[model samples]
Target: MNRRRIAVVTGSRAEYGLLAGLMRLLAADPRIELQVVVTGMHLEPRFGHTIEAIERDGFAIAARVPILEDGDSELASARSVGRAVIGLAEAFERLKPAMVVVLGDRTEILGAAQAAMLLRIPLAHIHGGEATEGAVDDMVRHAITKMAQLHFAAAEPYARRIIQMGEDPSRVHMTGAPGLDAIRDLRLKDAPELGAELGFPLEPGPLLLATYHPVTMDPTASVAGIEALLRALDRFPQARVIITGVNSDAGRDAVTGRIAAFSAGRANVLVKDSLGQVNYLSAMALAAAVVGNSSSGIIEAPALGVPTVNIGPRQGGRLRAASIIDCAEDDGAITDAIVRALDPAFRAGWPNPLSLYGQGDSAARIAAILAEAEPCLIKPFRDLGV
Candidate 1:
C-alpha cells in the first residue's frame, strides 16, 4: 500500500517532547510516511543542539532549514520568520505531503503553517483554542487555529472554542495533552538517581523545578518576576532548585542573566540549557513542587499528583487542576504559595488528583486521524454554530 505521506515540524526541545509519542506512532504505522522538518532552536548550539536529540530517537529528518541568525532582537525574529516561510514552502513543494502536522504556538510552526497554506497543503494543529494571557504564543496559537483544517485540542472546552471560532466541530478532536504520554508511559527515574544524573544532588528536602518565559504583554516585568521568584525561593534555604533555560523570546536575556548571576555561587541551585525530555519529566515527577509561569504546572504537574505554585500572569487564563496555587509575581505572594503547596494538610486534600487534559493516549488517536484526512483545496469556513 502507498502510505500517506505526512510532514511534521518541530522547532524546540519542549514541543518535541510533547509530540514524542505521536511521532513514534505515525512512524511505525504502515499507512503513514513521516517527513520530519527540523529547525529553530533544534539547530542552534546554544539551545543544546536538539536536532541530534531528535535523530537519536530514530527518525530520519527530511529537511534541515536554518532560519534564525542570532535572534537577539525583535527585527531579527521577524526576519527569521520570513526566512522560515520561504524555506518551509520549498520543503513542502519538494515533499508534496498529503498533510502538514504542526504543534503548539511558536514562530517555527506559525511560519511553517504559512508555507503550507500558500502551497494549498492540508494543515493540522494541536493544542489549539487555549489562552495564555501574558505570552505572545497566545496570539500565535489562535492564528494557527484559523489556518488548520483539523484541530486536536487537549481539552473539551478548547474543542468548543475552536467551533466558536467557526471551525467545524467535526474537525476538532479532544485527545488530551500529549505531554502526559511520557508521564503515563515512561518509567520516570526517582529523585536520588535523577539528581545524580542531573548533577544536582537533590537532598532530602523540598525541590522546586521551574522554567519561566518572557511575558509578551509586558517584557519589562519578566526580569522582575524572576527576581521575586528567586527571592521567594531564597526563603527556603534548604531547598534544592533545578532551573531550565528560558525560551527564544525578545526579552529572554534578562531572565537568563538573572538566573546565571543569582545561581553562580548558590550551592543548592543548578541551572542548565536543558535536561532532555526523560530527565526533565523524571525531575517533575520527583519534585516537591513545580513552580513558575510554565503551563507544565497547569497540565503535567496535576497529572503527576504533584503540587504547583504558578507565579504571575503567563498562564493567567488556562484551565487548571484543584491543586494549583495561583499567586501574583511578587516575592511575598510566591513565597506564600510555595509554603502552601508544601503543607501536609493541603497535600492531603489531593490524594486522588486529576488532570483537566487527557489520559495520555492522544498520539494513537492523532495518528489515525492524520492517516485518513487527505489534502484538499475547498475548506469552506466552518460556520460558528453548524
Candidate 2:
C-alpha cells in the first residue's frame, strides 16, 4: 500500500496553531504522509521565527517559501502574494502531492490555492464559508472555497453555506474548527508559568489579551484603528494589556508603531511578536477579557469562558459566541465595551462548551476522512444543491 502524500501550507503563526493538531495526527497516521510548507511570516525573525516552532514539534518541513519583504506597502503585500503563487506552484510541481491543504483567508492561502488549481492538484480547504466582511480576506476565503476540491467547515451553518456556494455536499465535511481541537486537548501552562515565560508579571486586575491585525481593505483606517484601540486601553489603566503582533499584511508598520508608542511609558502593557498556542490559551484562561479583532477572541475566547470586546470590523459577520461584545473602531465605544465585558453579570452568563466551535475531536475526524475518502475527479462550479 502506497502512502498518500498531502501537502499542508501554513502561512502565519496563527494559522499554524489551527493546523498543528491536524499535522500531528497526519504525521502519526501510517497510511498518510504529511508534507508541511512554512511560508509568509513563519520565515520572518520578527515573528519569533515560527518555523522553528514547527520543527520543534517534530514535523519535517517540506518547503519554506519566502514571500514577505521589509516594506509594509500595498505593493509589497501584492508582490508577496505573487511570489508565494510562483513558489507554491514550483513546490506542488516538484512534490506532486495527492492534495494541497490550505486554511483560512490569508493572501498566502489564496496564492497557494491558485497555484494548486493551476497545477491540477486537488485542494482541501479548511474554515471556508465563514464571513469576515471587514477585510479583503472574506473575498480571498470565498475564492479559495470555489477552487478547493474538498471543504472542511467549522459549523453546520458554514457547511450549508459552502454547499450553497455550489460545492458538492459530499465533498464538504463539517469537522468543526481544528483550532478548537487543540484548545480542548492541550494542557495549557498555569498563569504564573505563562507569565514567567512571557516575561510579564501576572497582575490581579483585568488582564486583556489583545491581538489586532491590519485591515487590508481599509488601509488608511489600519493605523487610526490601532491608535483608537490604544486610546481605549489608556482608559483602562488598571488593566494589564498584552498585545500580540500584527499579521503580515499591508500597513503592519502602523500597527507596530502604535503598539511601541503605547508601550513606551506603560509598565502594564507588553507586546510580543508571537505567542505559541499553549501560552495564548493560558493567557485566555486567565484574562478578564479579550480585546481585539483577531478571530481567536471571536471564536476561541468564548469557549474558554472569557469575555471578548471585539473592536472594529475585521471579524464582523462570523458566528460569535455569547461572550463576545462587538464594537466599532471608535475609542469611546471600545472603552465602553471593555467595561461591559468585564462586568460581573455579563461574565456570569457564559455559554456552554457544546454551543461553541467544536467537541475537540476535529483533528481525528479530519485525519480519518482524509485517509478514507476516495480521490474523485473534482469538477469546478458543480452546484451541490442543484
Candidate that would win on lDDT: 1
lDDT of 1 by residue, 1-386 (tens): 99899999999999999988999999998998999999888998888989998999999999998888675567777788898999999999999998999999988789999999999898999999999989888988999999989999999999999888888777889999999888988888988889878777887778889888887778888988999998898899899999897888777778889999989899999998988989988888888999999888999999998889998899987997888999999999999999898887877767464788988888888888888875665667767533
**Which pairs of residues collide in model 2?**
none
Question: Stretches of candidate 2 above 4 Å error?
Answer: 384-386
Tens-place lDDT digits, model 2, residues 1-386: 89999999998889999999999989999999899988999999987899998998998989989888779898988898899999999988888899888899999999999999998888899999999988989999999999998889998999999999988888999998887787779998877788788888877667898888988789898888898899999998888889998888888988998899889989899988888888888888899999989998977887778889898888988898888899998999999999998889986766566246677788888889888877755566655534
Error of 1 at 244 (Å): 0.7
CA lDDT for candidate 2: 0.88
Off by over 4 Å in 1: 351-353
- Error in Å for residue 113 of model 2: 0.5
